[model samples]
Target: MSGLQPITRSSQLSVEVVWLSAADGVLRYRSEAHPLDGGVHPDDAAWHVSGLTLCTPGALLHSTSWRYARGSVVLTYVALPDPDPHDTVAVPTDAVTSGGGPLHPSPAVIPIEAVAAHACRHLALLAVTDPQVAAVAAAESPLWTLITKLPCAPAGTLHPAQTTATAPHTAC
Candidate 1:
């Protein structure tokens, strides 16, 4: 083990999970440290962490995207924990903009809020396109409401800080 050791993508795999819950007509989210055990898939790790973090079950766990950050390929996930707030923070749905540039050949630095926001936007897309996801969202009242409230635009189409309240959803 020295300074010149090479690294592969799999060697640096890790998971980062955002706990999201809808309350009072808005989405609230929180994230906690999740240490990974070797040989566990990132998505499964996210589910395990979510289970440990939230007591109630039935939270929709989905892997939205991956970003390179902190010297590792971080797989991001969102878990919807509702009917049991669990001290989450509220973020405006319109803050769904990526923090930095695209991760083509460089790692982009993204904040947790932005990550969670992106997750919500991704789910909103699923809500309309995927039948199974749509059914799940429909069953969850709060999740469905928040997903409906969000502008149904594919990721990267909407500009940053676009006021969703005044903007027309059809434009998305």
Candidate 2:
């Protein structure tokens, strides 16, 4: 019975993104609030986000990218704003559909460097906000171990000094 444990899907598993402003460096949880009130726009080049998606059997997806000079990250797939008409060519009116129409574009790929950078920031935030979790993370906990194993996460990114617990607490 101690071997491999049976896996089950849990509806309680969920995911959400935490956004940061590239302009002013403000942090906000993504929600229904208006962009002016802390919400985020998918196409806004001035915003970035970091989040985790937990799938069945323990899969995790981290959304982050390094292509932008400012280091932007997006958690979900989004349709980019259309290009300016002046930079486009007119399509033929006689075009026919193959099946229905064009397929949805794939989500943007995030580089490991960006993902690691964001994860480090999130860990620091958690340490500051929750002493309990911070204590666990600071003790070389499994969660911290998993973060260090991320294929994209660079070495020394999860150093103890960076993710150290801010509040005083007994070691577990």
TM-scores vs. true structure, each candidate: 0.72, 0.21
Report the alpha-carbon TM-score of model 2 versus the true structure. 0.21
Predicted structure with the largest TM-score when compared to the true one: 1
Residues 93-171 of candidate 2 have per-residue lDDT tens digits of 1222111112422223433334334544444444445565455446553335433333343322455864546666556
- Model 1: CA > 4 A from native: 1-11, 33-35, 52-58, 82-84, 96-108, 158-172
Best candidate according to lDDT: 1
| C-alpha lDDT of residue 147 in model 2 | 33
Which 10-residue span in candidate 1 carries the lowest summed lDDT?
98-107
lDDT of 1: 0.69
Query: In candidate 1, what are the lDDT values of residues 106-159, reduced to their tens digit?
Result: 324567777778788888888898886787777757656877677787877856
* Count of backbone collisions in candidate 2: 0
Total backbone clashes of model 1? 0
Q: List lDDT for all candidates, in order.
A: 0.69, 0.30
